[model samples]
Target: MDLELRHMRYVLVLAEELHFTRAAARLGLAQSALSAQLGRLERHLEVQLFERSPRSVTLTPAGEELVARAGRLLADADDIERQLRTLSRQPTAPRGLRIVAETIHPEVVNALAQRHPGMAVTLRHDTAEDGMAALAANTADVCHGWDLPSVPLRMRSGIAQATLVDEPMWAVLPEDHPLAGEEQISLAQLRTAAWVSPGPGTRRARHLLSVCQAAGFTPDIRYVVDDQEMVRTLLANGCCVDLAPPRHLPEQGCRAVRLVEDVRARLFYAWRRDSVPGWLAREILEESRDAFVAGLVRRGPLYARLVEQEPARFGPLLDIDPAGWPAARIPVPALVSTA
Candidate 1:
């Protein structure tokens, strides 16, 4: 029983659609040609592949088995074709790069867009776990997040990664919140405040749990949302507090404080080492991630300016103290609530 990739593909697509005409449309083949191909395949294999009735087509036992077997063969053939095409210099064809980022970073976006004009990048807003999932499925080429050193993302699959930077996670509070007056509040000290955080299983939520538990209390939670903008607005209303990478905060409208020495979170990028290319596109992407991180570091003063505006968040800007800057910014003295 010798079957070609085209035959196998026809079987799989036919089985999936259970309709000769629709499957042909999906495969970009004429309906009559598709039917002829199926007839040839069935005759060659000496198997009646489908039980055709007026309204529906059902797979015969033999048809089901052949379709299943054909799926694997078709997949292998497709893989071989993709590998060959990419390995060869196909004119004007873009090498695909699937990158999963925790959230989008504008600098990284801009930097990469300029260098990799021909590269195809599929972006997914994913958690670190989502990134690991993408890596395991061989869907994504690279994943980026804060470069946490100690947190080993050991998935029981074919994923490996490295740290790009060590930075602090910030406690985001509403501009009008009572605690925003102080330069910073300890994670433990914020126990009575209503919190907006991820579910307990998440890394951010887990860090908050560990920190509060360490500080001798469980945190008071008000909301658990995944969206960053939602996190900012909820905190900005002075109703609840949350945590995130300080650098990820809006340049205005939110107050971000470094987790008081004890509570912190880090991020990293994971990829299947073998899937990444040893080509110019990969190198350029790596460089872009590096430059974006550097630019974030250098732009601490701009962040401070946001803090000082006190239109909300960190009120009444303090003078620029680049002392330990980027590493640490002096808390702008909280704006006094005139009300």
Candidate 2:
């Protein structure tokens, strides 16, 4: 009979065990059966594969060579089997997409579910830098975050990006603070006041420094914290003031006042080059924009007052005219308290 994979496996096991009974047990066969099979295989090739004595068994020189070759052959065969299994599943398996971002609104997730019901979508929270790294490693399909000019050129290369919103930044102040009553605050007016900045060495920190410098004074940053709740606590306690975008809804103890300076924060949707199709990327961008607008509209009277008071600044956000600003097509659910 022609040799088969089973025969190679048999010889390899026997060579390692060096005992017919032990090798047979390992192979889940009776000792007599293993011996008979090997004997037939040897007779077919006219070779003595093993030297046997009543006390012990050892491999012949021919057996040694055969075992070495069998090891490599078995490895290759196993690899082929694994590859074939993977190929077999490709046709039937559903596609999966992963998005890395600081936050993903529930509305966006629901919209994607309605658009591509079969595609599985996973959301993970990470900084913009780490999110881009995930995209480069092919572990994530997209990233959503601020697009600041301070980001490294190396990180920007080989990535496709779409800008979702470009809006003015706002000053986050304690409700009891002196400047908090103002509808708009200038950076220069608060240059001497204590400030809460993000962690040093981060892109946000650098951007804050640059914006402060443009207003003619370095920020007197008294606290460096990254957690939003902690920052809000500090502001609520009247410890310091911070800058945030309009999308960052004001909390109970804080107010979001528009900055007099023209400084703006840009929101971006990004993906690796050729990793996501152009059409799919655009769909995500559009969905994200709509969800963001819906959130602003749902921010209650505080934002509504801003839209009414500063029509030139906040009016474009709610413009429903088809030619001016695109309104959300997806249904906006009732406002849920994030507090």
Candidate 3:
């Protein structure tokens, strides 16, 4: 006989509630019955899933893995059933779209909602790992992340991608530093400065290392931080020399100078290749791309203002490479967007 969904549900509820009595009540079953169901599941799977004491029950490592996988399975099952019921009522078009990004452009959200009033759009903030996980589990139709994976460790195979931006590198320095006095810095001069970075595995790391190689010397890294805001604070306080987009320059205390060469990073939008964007989803993707570019343009004024402060040393305008963008761009309608 095949394993039924009841066993999965039993495990999920137990994992959620933690206590046997509470989980049993939530599942509308007796404590003894729930316990028996869990035990049967454990035996069938040939794994110990729980570590229970009198006061509490916690999932073992194996159990934690099972619960995460099972939770996604349950959610997908529910969505499929709900979609079928919705289809029975009206088969005209898709009712909603789902998207997840690290930081969303507000204009993109507004334009998508206004342009397709019939389509409901849901947004979630995600990390690179979270976005990758969402795509793999089919929880999200698409995601944007900094790094593209070579193996199918998490994400499914055959996901198509579109690059959106080549965020140019800038050298963040203290106001008092001697190099800060220069109008245009040479690569040799910049490499000698201490570096602040996110560490070696990240795209930023790759860019930072590449910057040093081009400059003819490796840098002495003084600090590491993942948060961009924190990086600015560290640079301002003299923790380490910072490198990032010109926009990431600390507003008040520190300054940023655009590197001379192609010292930059890329951001991309990726989706399952064989999958098609459902209703207004395709339009939403296009709107997002436009908003991101427009935001960069809007920041040009900011760069200009920084130029006044330092005069000759202020950074250059970061440019987007069209070739790095999606191979198959979404077709936008002739309608003028309100965003």
Candidate 4:
């Protein structure tokens, strides 16, 4: 009682072939079945769609009209089916893990790659504020940076954080500076030294200012540079001194002297509460912590001495057990003495 797509196909095929046996062969049906199906279609529509003779098959005027409409309908149906198949065959875009950090460690990234081979990973360096904003906006999955308690509660509402490491803030001075030779220097001793710090209004800059004020002298900030290399250049040229953690101190041009006051900076791994799965977040945090400690272990004598002499200060890193680290991957020499 109702028309179907098969009826349209049958009508068009028979019309094109003009022979029941030939049309049925092309349609992969028995000739009798094709004829019976056509009869059913005509009866349903209450009209003959084909004229037949012993010697030939021909389209009736009704058949001609029906075939004209059926051809268009069948063409549209085929096109839709083709489009659907093409869409089905196309692969969906791969899920990506985007990370923002102040410093990207290759070992951490490589560990992530090994753990999630199918996942696409990307890392970029950005300020802590921007990194937090990216996590809130769903543009980033994770962020590695200094923990700032001064961040407003609203900005941190849906963010989860884990402490990665607490590194002591060292005085990065020119290798030949007057106080560079001191095993430990007090902040008061550097009161007259010109300072190179991050740009004004940044969280780091604000923290630096507060730290200096607490240390009993306002630092005469002579140079404001955000790039680490440029900051190193300024220090290397003996233009200014700056505070940095062991990992951030320049290897070639600066001497990192321990602060006598034991000032420390806590590095954090942060992410939106809902951005990553719980297991993945834990894995990333663990891997980041391990990589950071392993890097310190491989950072030559200074950090080795810190780890060796001040195991209490670095208890968390020691808990992870650097002795378990693969010797081939990260060559860590015995921490016998300070450089």
Residue pairs clashing, model 3:
none
* lDDT for each residue of candidate 4 in 1-339, tens digit (9 for 90 to 100): 588998888888889899988999999999999999999888888898888899988888999899889889989999999999998975443367899997788888898877678889899999777887888788998888875443321346677776666777888899999999999988989899999988888877877777777789999998989988889788878788998886676657789898877677667677766656655776776676667767766663576677667767864465543344323332222211111
Q: After superposition, how far is residue 82 of candidate 4 from its true place, in Å?
A: 42
lDDT of 3: 0.65
Please state the error at residue 204 of candidate 4 in Å: 1.0
TM-score of 1: 0.55
- Ranked by TM-score from best down, the candidates are 4, 2, 1, 3
**Tens digits of per-residue lDDT for model 1 on 114-220?**
66677666788777767777777787777776433334454545455544433455677777666666766777767788888877687667767766677778888
Clashes of each: 4, 0, 0, 0
Candidate 3 local lDDT, 8-127, one digit each (tens): 798899998899999999999999999988888888889999998998899999999999989899899999999999979752434665667766677786786676688676778776
Instruction: Report the Cα lDDT for candidate 4.
Output: 0.77
For candidate 4, the 10 contiguous residues with the lowest summed lDDT are: 330-339
Looking at model 3, residue 152 earns an lDDT score of 21
Stretches off by above 4 angstroms in model 3 are 1-96, 113-120, 147-156, 181-183, 273-282, 302-339
lDDT of 2 by residue, 45-112 (tens): 89999999998899999999999999999999999999999978653323777889866677887787
The stretch of ten residues in a row with the least summed lDDT in candidate 2 is: 330-339
